[model samples]
Target: MLDKTLRNFDIPAFQQDLINWYQANKRDLPWRRTQDPYKIWVSEIMLQQTKVDTVVPYFQQFIEKYPTPYALAEADEQDVLKSWEGLGYYSRARNLQTAVREVVADYGGKVPDSPAALGSLKGVGPYTKGAILSIAYDQPQPAVDGNVMRVFARVLNIDEDIAKPSTKKLFEKIAAELISTADPSSFNQGVMELGALVCTPKTPSCMLCPVQEHCRAFADGLEQELPVKTKGKKQKTTTYAALLIKNEQNQYMIEKRAENGLLANLWQFPMAPIDEIGMEHITNWFFAEYGVQMNIGDKAGTLKHVFSHLIWQLEIFHAMTMQTETADERIIFVKPEDLRLYPFPVSHQKMLKYILD
Candidate 1:
């Protein structure tokens, strides 16, 4: 049993306590040091599905390379993808460039301050829009991502599935109501900070949480079980044969993925699903695709890479070629030293390590 109605509680006191706790205890993240919309926007996008420590260096490099919306808009797409190499969900990088180009062309190179205008940009969803408006502009919009949702679920002792769209909407509404008008930036960030720090998904330190006194879940001793999320579908495994074809000169062969879909435009060693394609068929297909004859060698090794929806079980094979160039436009022969410049998916990166090391 969960209480949906707002009970008579010291909401103002709760807000002050949480904000005070945040002011004293929030981690000194680079993104927190600025109100620049461009910087904040970049940080918000990079933070998507990525951990803070992992995003820090990438964020610094990206900001240095493309300091403004105009700069990012003008840069090459491949270069942008290269800059975002290791950060998975490469679509985020592509969509970010698209949205920044829109801002430069349409919004006079300025990130829109209003929720509606920001939301209209490509890949700018409710959470992103709310983040920009509230954090950058100090607007009273709720940014209810997983962290905010978890905090609210526990504070209110909510029993609904947090994975549901309706549940997210409900949490967003409650967050909007709870946002401090005087300092929406700190308030919104404070909630997320609390969730990330004290009220963590596992082993939440309710005893240390600033809002513990007002938390219904804490009062009812249900903090651990409040924010119930349904388990996602199991990822389907797919087998792949990754070809590491090298020439006599030690240049490796790579190809650009198709313009659309997963890892689009990123460079990868020629690989194919191994369902119906056998070793002999693969060697022939390689010549057909790249117009370069290869001598297949010993099995290198195997690696497993997991994406959100699928699992890639890759079988690595070493091969040699006499030709140093490719007749196919999509394929390119690059020296081992130059491979670092091309953006490779983690799966291929691992394969390269197996070959090099």
Candidate 2:
């Protein structure tokens, strides 16, 4: 009997309820004012696995720097990453840069209106493409983000594992059915807003929920159970060694990372895996490679940064060095005051801040 109630759901009343709520309570976000695909694309990309408040400043700064797809394509990748500092998931920043290049070279710097064409661009995955089409172009496309998934699972009282790809397809079909063709952009925003503010993950404000009457989860007192999820794999941990070398003039030595891997193209103190490393080996490597000698200082502290799949346990050590020979190596010695000029990851920022204070 409960199972049957979960099936054969109707969405018109729910849609109306959400639309009404959004008309009055929607946030005055900058991205909501314009229908520009480029702005929409940038916001959606930045919003992935990130909160709205965190993304607002980044969006403003990125737009001020890039302004358009052609501008972003022509700018340096490091500059793009620099603007995206403090935002996790470095790949999204890289992909945004790559997508800009593709948009300029292939699509003449305009985002595609059709879903298939939008999806063809680099980093414009299904969810992103749907968002752009529906929100910017007013197309009746299904943007099935985590928020919408939660809303649909509870409204229909679905217990089918929401983690499955099939569940996404099912939700997409249902969303497309509920979307008001008269104003798809409004309808899409309404549903997304409902999920974000009303049907939140914990202690949902059901009193304010627009469609509480039609929600099967509300009736059965199973709002938390309807959107069933499978447990995800635990994050893997990795160790890092940072060599905090200081020169005779009280300046620190730092290097720019290659434009790949974690925290790509950012500046940081020299680092190597410490499990198979020793102080003697580091001293030898610096002298042989860069012709610099150093007296190892005491261990300053350790910092940890967590990414989606990997965890970094960074062990930072302080050392003093004097240059024996002047060579134009890839390393730069900068005073603490000038550290802000170069872009660095949050982990490195924290380390520098700690040492400075």
Candidate 3:
């Protein structure tokens, strides 16, 4: 039944068209060459919610620094976070490190080839597992990314709101059935490439499309109308941070963020919620938490940071402590030289320089 449906679908022509186009047009991405599941895994994770050009240098630098799972596992969290700086979604970096540790401990530092095993790794989701299994292990798994979603919707003339879960399942089922039986890597890359290059979300270059003839949307003159997406909820804006920095005797007082919030487990200058950052609020928080008296100094500056759902308008303050502090409770003072050994988000780092300079 599947074969019959595919026969009437011009599968060969579309496959050949995409394959020929890919042979001549696919970009020379480093991850495309090796069947190393580790390399492919890293690339796919970095590529999520990120662009290819951004992932390239990061991938190259990361692989150069930590060439193996064992190496990545042995790396300090600070070093790992530093490497992942500027690539937001800091949690992904933390999860990647956790996953490396798991791979080293359970799999003996060799990345698993099976989809089930790969999917079991920390931070390895359905799309990532599919990408690794197919691109690295030659498994006929369909990696459904946004590009693939768009391509499948247009190619099949699907209009059941691509945002719907049922629509996604239908696309995945069709993708698995249509997957090339040979060299799944090439086939997967061909689909991803066609979607990214020719059948883009907006202003698709249909005149240059390889499988335009097989595209039901193109045949119906609805290529621009397919893959209907429902509007998403507005990203709520909330502000909750104002970084505070204290520089004394070449040391900066920095605090480790809680392990669950944005940029968790990363170092930052002592920060309080926006509502708790005035002169009175800072003094009250310090007295309540540490029983220490502090003389609030000049306002160094404010740093504005944006997350996917929240915005932080941080007003940094400089201050001097009443006594030499020990690294005991919430805040710790570290020399500027030692500060380099810790990973601080850019927002905190910006405030640190304001005081250190």
Candidate 4:
């Protein structure tokens, strides 16, 4: 099927047109300014499930702080999480740091140039590996991410469900074969850029597409229907109660999450499940965990945060601490202003806003 699909279009012309259009019209992103493997690696990791516009400032700030693999590897985990505060996917930051540490320890603090070496690092999957190789090293590798998949599906008029692993493999194969050996970097970026700006998911700008003449979906008037994807499983909603405990000096109590779970190593107001036992159970759990007695007060506010796999319905509660001395190392009491130094998940961040406001 892939061979037959290639036969229907002029491959050379398609590549040339796409590359020309990209070089002429590509967005002036910060990452595009340099072929530095470390910078490109950072940008690519941050770009996963995140928009380019949103990533720009984060990328700039992050690179300024941790300019090299050695810097990132040497930074504290909490500091790293703080640097990645609003980026949402905290694990990406953690995993990238871990991988960078490996690079420093084993690969001489340089991001590996070859595909195989880059791929062996933690969190460096196929797309990231290909991106690092093609964009940084100018290797003829295919980075078939969602945007690329969308572009290829429309260009080839493929109707396979993109959510399936098999579909991703097919797209990767097609991209590898189609990649321009002389300039894979621009070609891959062009494909993604075209998908992002012109061949949008809802309403593609067919007339403005550079490769429209060779696009199978354009010829068939089926651009919108070509990149088929199955719907994901429904996200489970879990109810939690976030406690804002104030000490005698008006300091708020916060706790760091366990090192190996969702939102790991991030700070948050002490929280407990809002189960059948209700606020009483939450209070009990808080006291048990932190060794601090709490006098629960009026409800402050409610905040909802949605992750990729679950929805958190957080109910905020104001409370006064009955005991100041708690031996738990994970728990800390700090003035409200001090909270700025810690990284809290968006849910807790919203609750903090209500407390401060």
TM-score of each: 0.95, 0.89, 0.90, 0.97
The alpha-carbon root-mean-square deviation between model 4 and the true structure, to one decimal in Å, is 1.3
lDDT of 4 by residue, 163-257 (tens): 99988999999998899998999999999999899999888999999999988898999997878988999999988888899989889998988
Question: lDDT per residue, candidate 3, 252-290, as tens digits?
Answer: 667777888788878777655646455457677865655
- lDDT minimum window of 10 residues, candidate 2: 1-10
lDDT of 2 at 291: 63
Alpha-carbon RMSD, candidate 1: 1.9
lDDT value, residue 237 of candidate 4: 90
Screening candidate 4 with a backbone cut-off below 3 angstroms (N, C-alpha, C), the clashing residue pairs are: none
| Model 4: CA > 4 A from native | none
Ranking by lDDT: 4, 1, 2, 3
| Candidate 2 vs candidate 4, lDDT winner | 4
Q: Write the per-residue lDDT of candidate 2 for residues 36-89, one digit (tens) a residue.
A: 789899999999878889999999999888888888899987778788889878
lDDT of 1 by residue, 101-126 (tens): 99988899989997788999888899
Which runs of model 3 end up more than 4 angstroms from their true locations?
A: 1-7, 276-279, 290-292, 326-330
Off by over 4 Å in 1: 1-4
Q: Which candidate's lDDT is highest?
A: 4
Error of 2 at 31 (Å): 0.6
